[model samples]
Target chain A: MGIFYFVAFLSVFFALMTIFTKNPVHSVLYLVITFFTFTVHYILLNAQFLAVVNFIVYMGAIMVLFLFVLMLLNLNKDTEPMKSTLVKVMGAIAGMCLLATFLGAFRVLEGQNEYVTGNTDVGLVKNLGKVLFDEFLLPFELSSILLLTAMIGAILLAKKETKQG
Target chain B: MEGAFILEKLILVVVVFTVTLVIAMYSTLAERKIAGFMQDRYGPDRAGIFGILQPLCDGGKFFFKEEIIPAGAHKTLFILGPVIAIITACISSAVIPWGQDLVINGRTVSLQVADVNIGVLYVFGVIALGVYGIMLGGWASNNKFSLMGAIRAASQSISYEIGMGLSLIALLMVTETLQLGEIVAQQSGFVNWNIWVQPLGFLIFITCAFAECNRVPFDLPECETELVGGYHTEYSSMKLGLYMFSEYINMFVSSALMATLYFGGYNFPFMYDLGLSQNWITIIGVLVFFLKIFGFIFFFMWIRWTLPRFRYDQLMNLGWKILIPLAIANIVLTGVITLIKDTYFQ
Candidate 1:
């Protein structure tokens, strides 16, 4: 439990740092660290499969893509256009609104902390697979279709740009 | 009792750590020696008997060498890069089942450090993290060449990983378990090895493994004639050594994984016929596991010296167009065959 709090604090710290970092590359690295802390949280929750998957998919693959593009663009602090005070103030106002919304939603669910459990094998691969294949098969298959469509769309867009250029 | 258990685990961890470092260190010497022998010359026979002490000399040199960070480089990331590389490399050995089990003082101890149910997934996750080391090093160098090399490495590793994971799916279908120890137990004898059942998957796996390890024919990221040491171009001293060391360690771990997944890890034929005691059997099993690992390492070196590096486009095409489809087909075929056997033959 103590370890969990430590990791949680680090995750939130890194999450904030990701946004506030001056360098884009450093921001991406901090985001990767944030994802790693989330992975640690998953392990603590006894969802080892999800933890590993989160590490592989988020920290490993997606963050590499993020870093790759950031590096390729070669954006530095010097080249970054300064935002006006009005724009910064509006951004903070919008962030505050989102935080208030989240707090209100949590407040509505605050009294529903009753621990009810059965078939506690939720995170194990075998149980997850059974649940997905048996109960949520339609949604699972639809999600795959959505991913496939997105992939094809990306390829087509890339190919068309290459041909035009 | 708990203290004893903790002590045992500590000893095992230390032993595994030492063994991994020793193997990686020697692999550098062996790679050079093999390369030299292929070119008809003696390789590093100056230090000690047949250059046995060459790794020590190399380590000493790295320690004494002047460390440099480029003027415009990201200092924090430059240091973090190699540290990430070596840490990821070392942590990967945790899931591998080095041997069956050892009995000491009337207690049985598993050879593996962690026997997590999702062993294969853990290995995959570690392999995936490996790209960051190269990518960060290259990007932090603030050099265009280094950046390009890192980009190449990231794409290459990501591309190959797809095929590798796809090939592994077929093996998983056959074994029906993700635990490395369970997979080995299933292949108790020579005849029961997954290689016989899924030869095509093994072929795809080995090809992807070559790409994953950044060996010849797939080493475009760091090809000397092209990117000038690739991601490590701006690195010097022990930082550079760490990158190189991590590569060798990656090779060692990958070889051990391949031996475990496909080649019946720590299993020997006719062990029961020999009627050896359980302890002796385990000892032999551990020795056999090392033998298999060494065999795969030698194979890696042999191919490195023999094959020419693939053109970048050709490498990408092979990874995506050829290997991925082949692995998918292998998985489908395995599924169909398993279905037929269960429905008709059974």
Candidate 2:
């Protein structure tokens, strides 16, 4: 329990530091650290696959791309969107309210035992593939469509104008 | 959970880390030597006979050199850049299974630090994060060249990553497991190496590996004449050293990955044929693993000096127009073949 708490505390601290850091590059880098600590959390939870995926997609691909964008923009100045103390306090209050509401709602709910998974095969790669391809065929196909739209959107946005225009 | 187990894990981790670090360090020497020999010149003959101590000397130089944070650079980010790079590059090895588990004194010890079901994915994930090191270092350097280099790296890495992931899909389909150990286990005996079954995947894997490591032919990001030191343009001393060292380290990791994935990891010809003792078997396993790693490393260095880099437009075209589509086709072909084999051949 103590070990778990220690990891959780470190995770939260690093995450807060990531967002609070002034330099965008530093912030992105810290976010990488935060993602790593999350992997640690995932390890503690025995969700090895999630941890690895987190490392690959969030830390490796996404954050690096973010840092690249930050570099391209040359956003080294101290002027990028640092909220005032009053704004921070107000945001904190609103955040707490949202948290309280969510907890209160989940607490009051009486139908919570809807899904109990005593099965160990729940997270296996084989099981995941079966479920994804078989049971979720519609959504899976829909996602392909979504991806196709995104590709077309990107191409449309990036296409250069002709001289005749 | 006992002190003994903790100590054992510690010893294993330290041994693995040191071996990896040493290999990476020597890879730099090997790279220079290859380049020197290729150019018909001496590589390094000073600092211990035949420059054996060259790596150590280079480390000393990096340590002694002044740590210069350029004026107008983000001070904190400037420092954080290399630290992130080195640490990320180092720790990504955690999930890699060095060899099979060894049992001693009634304790069953696994070769890996973490035997998560998603071992392969974890490797991918950790490597993905590695790009940030280069990205951050370049951005924080506050140089146009650095920024340009960073953009090139980011684009190149992400572009190649699609092919990398796609190439692995065939392997995943074949093995039906994401654990690196299980992957190796499935390929235990001879004739089962993935290189044979998934030849196209293997080719794609090798090409993507080269791109992922930013080596020659895919090294548009840091082509010297073009980008002027690329991402590390403004870096000096140890900061620059870290960027360069991390590349070699990344190369080492990728080499280990290639060995582990395509080759039968640590299962050389005739290891069990001798029927050696446990400790001796472990030693042989580790040695064989290193031999394979060094072989791959030598290949990496040989190619680095041998091949010229691809043009930027050509590199992008290769990734998107060619590799991604081929990777998808490979996956489809692999799936169909597997289905056919299972349905009829089996």
Candidate 3:
């Protein structure tokens, strides 16, 4: 649909702005806008839960953290480390490689894009919950456990540093 | 039919918007009056009877005041901050059901703006996004005090939101749906209210609501003693007014949310026993709902006046250590009890 393309374009544009912005805080703000576009995209796809979760987690919490760190860093042009030509060339090479891989992957899956077809209600909470719990329960629980482990590790590291100091 | 539906929703949205603004406006006066009452002094009674026209005068003062932008401030974001604040504060009212449906000329008009399936989450997301307004405002000012205030706000909101979400999870389990209308509908009679069921969850929720709204006990973001007006240190005139006004608006929305979630919103004790018409019931329900909202708003002011502000560390500890654990335990307890009730009692 036209609305979908417009939102998609907005997402891409904001994502580019996030990367290209000179100021770190402005970059994070652009990233927040990018995340908002993703939320809109989820709504367009009828994934109400996904849309709200993206809005809260990404735009609200994560972006705030990003901006917080940037604000504390107080990065400006005078303080920024200048990149050498070699580093710049390498970065461009890496970026182009990433682009090539993404394009190739899309080309490979060009005809196999059937995951979201013919099911307007698939993204609704009830159906999504049923599928996640009944079919993908293992992966779901495993992901949660991974997050829990990371959280515990971080807390332990923090405690150890406090005791050492 | 389509045109009528659109018109009806437009009217509802306009009504809800106006009511929210009006309540936020009067809440300023009410808060001061209540503070005066607590201090055993006459409040602002000079404007009109009991200072009824005080809010209008205050609005005029704010508009007439000279606006200032700091020389070092980021110009764009400085303006964007309060704009985002007030807009987010107002939009959260869209999903709140003010009363039961009113049937006029055989057309049933729901009292809510949108009966979206994710109504609860929508409110949660909007409220969560409210921190950006403060953060942006504080950071853009390019002042150390403002930046500190912004940082405190960011951490405070993040910490409290977890407890809030966990508390809501317990309520969601009991209601078995995220739809606000459905949740209200389930608690029709007096005894069916969720407050009696999830008392601990309600406590955690109200505490987090206070923190999320940046009220008295959790109001480190704008503590006047050390930071000098905190995040709005460099803000002036109506821009500063927007920040303050948005806080009151947030209070109104959260109070409405509390009434809707726990108090059996718009559902009185025994409506059917009175044999009133549906229209009359709807009308009375709207009045009753507003009464509940006012009660909660008063409670907000009461706590604000009564309690001292929490130390930053104490606030963080209360949020993360106390409230989060209690909320998680409440969810677990709700789950186990529900399972037991279904298997054995039922």
State the lDDT of candidate 1 residue by residue for A1-165, as single tens digits: 899999999999999999998889888989999999999988887777788899999987899888888888889878888999999999999999999999998887676633213444576778778878988899999999999999999998777454434
Query: What is the C-alpha lDDT profile of model 3 across B274-323, one tens digit per residue?
Result: 99999999999999999999999999999999999999999989998999
What value does the TM-score of chain B take for model 3?
Answer: 0.99
The interface RMSD values of the models, given in order, are 0.7, 1.7, 0.7
- The C-alpha TM-scores of every prediction are 0.95, 0.87, 0.97
- Tens-place lDDT per residue, model 2, B234-343, is 88898888888888889999888888899877776666678787667666776787788889888988888888878999999999999999999999999999999999
Off by over 4 Å in 3: A84-90, A93-114, A160-165
lDDT (0 to 1) per candidate = 0.91, 0.81, 0.93
Candidate 1 Cα errors over 4 Å, as ranges: A81-119, A161-165
Q: State residue B314's C-alpha deviation in candidate 2, in Å.
A: 1.4
- Winning candidate number (TM-score): 3
Candidate 2 runs further than 4 Å off: A1-45, A76-121, A161-165, B103-109, B275-281
Q: If you assessed candidate 2 against the hidden native complex, which CAPRI class would it receive?
A: medium
What local lDDT score does residue B224 receive in model 3, on the 0 to 100 scale? 91
Best candidate (score: DockQ):
3
Ranking by TM-score: 3, 1, 2
TM-score of chain A of 2: 0.72
